[model samples]
Target: MTLPVEAGLHRSCCLIDTASLSHNISVLKKGLAPGAEIAAVVKSNAYGHGVRIAWRAFVEGGATWLCVDSLHEAQELRDDGYTGNLFVMGHIPPAHAKTAVSLDVRCMVYDRRQIDALGEAANAASRPLRLVMKLETGTQRQGLTIEAALNLAHYIARFPYLVLEGTATHFANIEDTTDHSFAYEQLRIFNEYNDILTANGFRPTLRTIANSAAGILWPHTHCELVRAGITCYGMWPSTECYVSARLLGKDVDLRPALTWKTLIAQIKTVPAGSLIGYGCTYETTHESRIAVLPVGYYDGYDRAMSNLAYVLIRGKRAPVRGRICMNMCMVDVTDIPDAEPGDDVVLLGRQGGESLSAEQLATWAGTINYELTTQIQTNIPRIAV
Candidate 1:
């Protein structure tokens, strides 16, 4: 059968492994206690694996709690027939609190104004609204300060219309060993707050502070639930997390669930001393064969990776020559005698007998895998296989 060309660049399509996702869920399950449910953090489109697909696989893999960034994300899941516990991890503005309550979505309460609004909305509708209070220890991005958190907890305890269903803290550096002590400090503050709540006769149904890295490396901190994001996709939250897990004698046999594949847009043999790509960043040192790949910065491969990366073509790794343009890049393939047009190219996955990981690509970009995967443009199609 002949292949049909799609519109635009149509470079790489990502293949996601629903099975690996299930496997990772199983691995995380081993860390939880009986009846402890995991909240699959599907925020940011399941960290770029596509939200709907990840949500389906997550539910099927035994996750009952789903966490998202906004009411719209929770509504998207609801629209798709997901009937389970849904919590908005990020703050939902007071304007959106009614929608969250009406949709049966829990909101994250980070400030006093949100709580007051939620209480008023819930009371007017004859419904009790659920919210999780976020405590800020050191991250200093969101969440209430120590004194504010204490006051909020006490005030919420007296508010009958507003139910504090959970309390959570997000760590700024859960993946760095040097920052491990900082993470511990956050946990200590969380524990102290928990103690204060208990003493004040304010008991929340759930208390959680562990993210993917903390859940994997610091089990003692997994109070009642854990918010897992990157690890669910088989990507390590950070190098320190993986190293710490290894040192702790825990086996997190994770396989990356996303694979990106494209095809040769064109192939040609250029004469010696020929200049290549925009700004002529690279020149042909010798008569060489090159393959044009229809993938570039616009697709989220990153212009920073220009002239510093490689792509897998015909089971061989070829150095990307010159600069990576918005729509294409070139790889020298002179040594691969049979390389040709329409041949499959691997940008971030297994190709024939070799493989390339986003981790390695992130290193080349001087960034992280999370950034690389999340930066993938919305234009590309993602398929689950």
Candidate 2:
């Protein structure tokens, strides 16, 4: 098999700094509560950083838990001989209960039918299947009501092969704005449910509530495990999240680990008043030298960034000149006279004194940084440096 780094034929690739990834996890780990373990969220192909390369970096940074969205991801990890603590935080189809059982992954469940299937599978395997209940505090997605949760807890107790090992809830707007009143309210409800669970016969030892934003801003939510999604890859959940951290005097630093880059395919000069790209959106104001990059919307560069985003060429800014196409985009290199074919251009990364951040690109595209990186096509090679 050809190693990922050996994919020399691809003109563009996401350069993943494993050191930066590891350091980001280490930094996030420091903010967690005592005895709390950091669980790196490696779902969506490790947020498009390529899970096969990202897992080891996070592990080196002291993150022992790996949380993927689906049982398929868990099975892939297991098949690859990864024996680390794996947690499936997403829905597991009842049809795949046998597969889930053989993988020995801790699955998050809320529905009774799915739980029953898993219980039966556990009995068949003659092994204990650990479960984490997703509690519904406010977010209506993938959770059970307090009474319903208590009921499920009791039902889970009926199966000697099943163990309710944990409880998890996601904050609705924890990172959306600096004001966290809504998030606090959600936490309040979660705490109450936990208290009720403890009062009953079932008490989950592992409590997961703190995501990347909460893990950095609030110590109280740092229960037994912190699910750090974007934080593991070195980016804040939001500007509001960063502002909140500063307001709360939370000292933390996160380094961006992924760099989207491509080689300039060609260069050409266009006369003044010349139309460029699909919609003729940009008209050249002057004679301009443009560098065509061998990457476009298909490679995860948002088309919304057309005529809006800029790339770094020879430590200079090369402004994108038109609408991004499916296989290519053009950037004005008039100012960067030294730019040429095969020259490495940074689509999102630091070069010299300039950098095109994921946040900046997402802003230009009217989206978030999380979507920006995660949307990158998985076929593109992820080179771990």
Candidate 3:
């Protein structure tokens, strides 16, 4: 019997280790303050790790709440038999009000129009809807100012179907800088807004301000809920976050669980001075052996990674050559002359004693680790191992 890989059933695939995902969640949860609920942000297909496969593992690893970015994701979760607390942190369009209400998801709201639509839908459906107010804590995105927040809180009180259950703010500077002074100020402003709300009798049960960076760097920011996103997948938010965490003596262990792989489609020898790929961007410096791999920009391998990234072949680094094409790319395998067609090529993951990290690939793509993993094409098979 031929194995699926050897049979060429897939051009490229991602191996998602559920055990490592669970381990990452458990490790993140360990750093949170007591009584703070851990919410796994499984939006964007669990950072492109396959939502269907990640949610179960996260739940198994002690995540009490699952957060998604849209009503569609919430519905998918509910349809998949995920009967737990679900938070919708993205926009709930006016058209999706009824569906959002039917899904029974807690929404993060900052606009009045969203409230009107959801309030009407919830009333029509005769189902109470919970909402978390997003306060503008200097992010200037998806949040309301103090005055706007107060007005919305009072407006929400008018609708019997709507109950404001929480207050949340995102730190814009937490992960990008080791100097957390700006983040601390954002936290102070968030708390001030919460105080104003409490003084006006809008008591929020859930006060959430801690994201992955804050959750790891400061236990004091972990109020009632901690939203763990990238870190939940065993990838750090940024180098600054990792440095800050280490400086603070809170380097919780994180293990990446994604291993992207493809197979060598062909191998050929080219004499020195030969032009390679689109735009003749590369020329062979010597008599070279080139291996063509069935993965490229369309496979979430960034076009910008051309001539800059390397792939793992038989425990050796095969430098990418020339411009990456829409559906394929070439790597110089002269050093590994024995590399043959059908050999497994690791795009991102461990191979032998060496490992290619998401961070490194992101660097080649001129992006971050989150975008690197999240941009991976969903069409690619994600095997949950």
Candidate 4:
């Protein structure tokens, strides 16, 4: 079967550096213990890098385990013929339990109802369902509550059809160096819960408590396996984590794997008093050259970044002007004397001496890097380099 191809029709696109992604994975893997396996988090379409491509890159990068946010995602990989270990890190809906079992996808059990459902589904399918029990240490998210973790683990372990392959916890403050005490406390709670399970005769094959940030800054919490998302995508989980890891002399060098590039649809010189784009949000400050780029909110370029964003053109910075339309944006390229239509506009990535990053753009949009990466819609063509 043929996958979708851009075929020269591009309004906006993200050029994925598969080599850079592989390099980032390799660098992060070196930080883990000798036997610790890398479970590259490819959920949200590998943070919008395209699942099929990202999954292939993860395997090529030596990732032994692949994690997704939902069973649907796991099924997608299974359908794509990925036979590696696939873990559904998100809460699996009751109706999808059978598909999870059939696909050999390890699911996350947050509550006993889910456990019961999975047991029934697995038994009906006449196969043991592998699962990871998530503990809600401090995230207050989907995982099992602190008060019920022990009992839940023991109860789930009693099910013959439910194979508790692992236990995991997500940290709430892994990036806060000054308040890593809370993250440490989370580690302690995870340890206690793991100990309880072991004492109760449940030897969970995999035990983990660190995500991207914790895996980078608090290496001590890297248990049997770490769920690395942002790091695997070659972006820092947070600035604090990156800075701290650098100071500690840890390997923090990761090349961003996704770079946005779109061709200029048109180029023109607007008069000094001309209004640019819709709602007249910006007026030309001088008689200047402008290049219209075929990208906007529909393509995951946040509208909030209207007056405060920058795009690279001809290796020079261009300030975004006016309200971003549904399918276009205007960039002031007056200073770039040789800018023209069909020229590559770098929305992100390195161009000459200038580099624009997802983190920087996310900052301008008043969001985080995770949101920035995952928000790239499927309509934009993603190319694996």
- Residue by residue across 68-140, what tens digits does model 1's lDDT show? 9988888899999998988888868888767877888878887877877787788778788887888887888
List the candidates' TM-scores in order.
0.94, 0.97, 0.98, 0.95
Estimate candidate 1's alpha-carbon lDDT, on a 0 to 1 scale. 0.82
Clashing pairs in 1: none
lDDT of 2 by residue, 1-385 (tens): 1224555777788889999999999998888789899999999999999998899899989998999999889987887767989999998989999988899899999988988899999999999999999999888898988999999999998888999998999999999998889999999999999999999977889999999999999989989999999988889999999999889888787989998888889999999998999999999999999889889999899999999999998899889988999999999999988888988888999878999899999999999999999999999999888
Please tell me which predicted candidate would have the highest lDDT against the true structure. Answer: 3
**What residue runs in model 3 are displaced by over 4 Å at the alpha carbon?**
1-8
Displacement of the residue 182 alpha carbon in candidate 4, Å: 0.9
lDDT of 4 by residue, 1-385 (tens): 1112562565677778898888878888888865577889999989988888888887888888899988888889998989988888887888777788899888888787788888888888889888788887788887776457667777887778888888988888787564578888888888888887788777777987878887777667777888899999888878788777877778677888888877788989889999988899898878989889889899888888997899988788999998888888999988999888888888878877899999899999999989998998876778887
Task: Please list all clashing residue pairs in model 3, or write none if there are none.
Answer: none
Residue-level lDDT for 259 in candidate 3 = 91
Q: Which candidate do you rate higher for lDDT, 3 or 4? A: 3
Runs of candidate 4 exceeding 4 Å displacement: 1-7, 176-178
- Candidate 2: deviation at residue 62, Å? 0.3
Clashing pairs in 2: none
Ranking 1 against 3 by lDDT, winner: 3
For model 2, the stretches where C-alpha displacement exceeds 4 angstroms are 1-5
Report every candidate's CA lDDT.
0.82, 0.91, 0.91, 0.83
